[model samples]
Target: MSVTPHVVPGQYREVSDANGRVYRVGETDRSLLGRPRAWMVWLPWIAMMGVSVYEYGYSSAEAVLEHAHGWTLTETFWIASIWAVFQAGVAFPAGRLRETGVLPARTAMLAGAVFSGLGFLALSHLSNPYVVIAGYSVLGGTGAGLVYATCINMVGKWYPDNKGARTGFVNGGFAYGTLPLIFVFNYWFHPSNYKMVLDLIALGMVLVVAFCGMFFRDPPKSWWPHDVDPLNRGVSEDARRVAKRLAKNPPAKGQFTPMEAIRTGQLPLMWFALVCIGGVSLFGINFQVPFAKSLGFGPLVAASSAGVLAVVNGVGRAIVGWLSDYLGRRQTLGLVLVVAGLAQFGVLWSGQAHNEPLFLIFAFLNGFGGGAFYPLFAALTPDYFGENNNAQNYGLVYSAKLVGGVGGGGVAAGVVAAWGYAGAYYLAGGIAFLSALITVFLRQPGAPRRSGDGSPVAEVGGRTPSPAEATT
Candidate 1:
């Protein structure tokens, strides 16, 4: 006897052959995509990316202050380092809240946005270093942490099948969003009246957050696309039938609980990969402006250069995401890491040469690696672990990056203080290479399975089930 999957009004039903392992009759709904809910979930993703850009802009503003206002290098490093630490501190709690469904994802994101906007607003007023620390470092940092954790978590849940692509796109948004701000700040502010510049940045952040809030929403239980299938292939027909019946009765409830995932081994490996990439990438991103200044670029040039890196970062993410969809996630990542390591070395060499064009080229290459690394990890994690606990797992992984940023930023600053800019860039490059080396140890979670005829089925289930499945 052979069984076919079918969809019914309230439940899924399937029959088994005499050999229980083979399903003879099954009802599987095919409408997981093309639902109103999928688009709804995507809104927050785009918004989160936008907010990430705002954060980069905020940090860039600090670089401007360091150069124009004569703020010490220690002052700049302390502010940025504290901000990253605050982000790390809040990550786990926010993830827990998301996992428990204590707050709607959009609400959390909006709250974070408001805090971020306010931080910039407050920053515009303060002249003292302590005030800058209080506003941007503590308050602003806290807000960024909350917003980032919520946004990435939501994306992971919404696009389980294409976790790599979806997460890459969202993460890419952060790098890309910086482009507009780069132009905006360059046009809006000059060193003569830096206070006015702060006010404008604050105002801009307010507008950006408000615009994002309009569209952000949590995906409904039934919001998946129609074509994608669930990856849990071994789920028995009876279990699926029971789940369908339950889903129909309480249509908004999730089938899997978060606690179940925390108990699994996959979460640890996923967390490890995320942290490793984040650690290396943040080290570069947070220090780019300072690194440029050390190389004899003035404040405006340094800030502009940082913006240029942001552009390359965005492009790298888009390319890597596209490739991840075609090539396997692990394979693409392995190759990217290797290339990133070499780029880091180039940056170190270019800094020693003191050639502006070489510095720009190396910066682009290094930024490309940094930009590509995170999104790939974002996509890969969901591939290994189920989406149910994505927020929690990603939050934990991000912490590693935050920790790395704290150390890396301070170390980069110290290197500049002692040996000059070339030494700092060299050190950063060495660290990136070390991170690339670690990628060699990554293995795809499962061995490939073959059909009776020995054909290979591509890996699926890293993203969310489509709309058709939810309705069925």
Candidate 2:
């Protein structure tokens, strides 16, 4: 529980391996940040929740937004779809900027706060769809992207030794954070009062992001926790727990540059899987409420379905993330995809049958399956590729969401118009199943290949390599 300052300021007893990857060891979180590393987790979690309303709660206000702006249903949905596009599209650029020192975390957060606030202002006052798209979709999505990328990175960087649960906890905040707003948009918001409410929400988002970001700081590159041995499996109790994790979900074989990661063929697979799963997740978020309403559900049922989705979506991330620690990332991910795929069909059948209780039950399963994959991919990127270039590496992987946003939102709406909800739900469910299949092919890049004798055959070195040494 107590950490003695072992490394002097600005210096570390660096450790290196055959791959030239360096770890700046011997610094405790308290020594570097003047607080426990847990602060990093909480701050990012709160900030993630602050911007969550942009995605998770936006659906509830669609009808009001359409009436106030004199837009059609499709137009309002496009706003959300476009918002998702920019929101996800900005991750790669933002990650590049953050990792290269071109934009510090604090500065990124401040800029996000300003832009996010303006995005709502644009939505509040602008009636023209194009202008609103530029302001709300582009600016607002970018703001959310910056915060989202930074928060996830912060958690991963601080807790590399055990990031699954921590990353999941922070990532979950992005979904459920919109719970209160979902109800407000459904019950209290109308065209007459929408502007005032949105303006207030914008201001609150700005304050939360800016305040939490003020304390944001990245640890020195390749920083490892002082108590955990980055190489040897220590005999200490903490080290033993870490060893167990390593056995299940080992760290990267070596630090991989973005291009290197791409060359390994694993990065592309990860991207494709994210695209598939993310589209399914976004489809649920955008359509669940509308689908309920279309099925002749009451106002409360419609809103409650969305609220339930948001809550389960968020909480499931944390639960599955923690579970992944012991269960192995690949196995847990496969399970999540399978469960989500089945739930999609369940939702469709229940809705068609007009079974409200059954519908709600499937909605719970749908919500759980919807948001859990995000944290897994977030953690898996660094798990497969070392954390040094993780911001940019994960950026590349997370960018799939841009395409997913379009597919799940605008493209999905078109599918609905053609085939109705039945066809669209079927497509989304199929995509989840495909992603689950992809999970079967995922293996740690550069890890030793088994020989005919069933012994580890060296792939990169003359002997069986440690998990972190296999990639190079």
TM-score of each model, paired residue for residue: 0.75, 0.93
Q: Pick the candidate with the highest lDDT.
A: 2
Lowest lDDT block of 10, candidate 2: 454-463
Cα RMSD for candidate 1? 9.1
Q: Cα deviation of 128 in candidate 2 (Å)?
A: 1.0
Estimate every model's Cα lDDT from 0 to 1: 0.59, 0.88
Model 1, C-alpha of 353: deviation from truth (Å): 2.2
**Model 2 C-alpha lDDT per residue in residues 1-472, reported as the tens digit of each score:** 2223465555445555444445656677887899999999999999999999998998898889989999987788788889988988888888888889999989988988888888999999999999999999999999999899999998999998898999999999999999999999999999999999999999999999999999999997788897777664477787788888877888887777788899889999999999999999999999999999999998888888899999999999999989999999889999999999999999999999999989999999999999999999999999998887889999999999998999888898899999999999999999999999999999888732233743222322123445554432
Clashing pairs in 2: 253-468
TM-score of 1: 0.75
How far is 269's C-alpha from truth in model 2 (Å)? 0.5
Off by over 4 Å in 2: 1-11, 17-20, 447-472
In TM-score terms, candidate 2 sits at 0.93
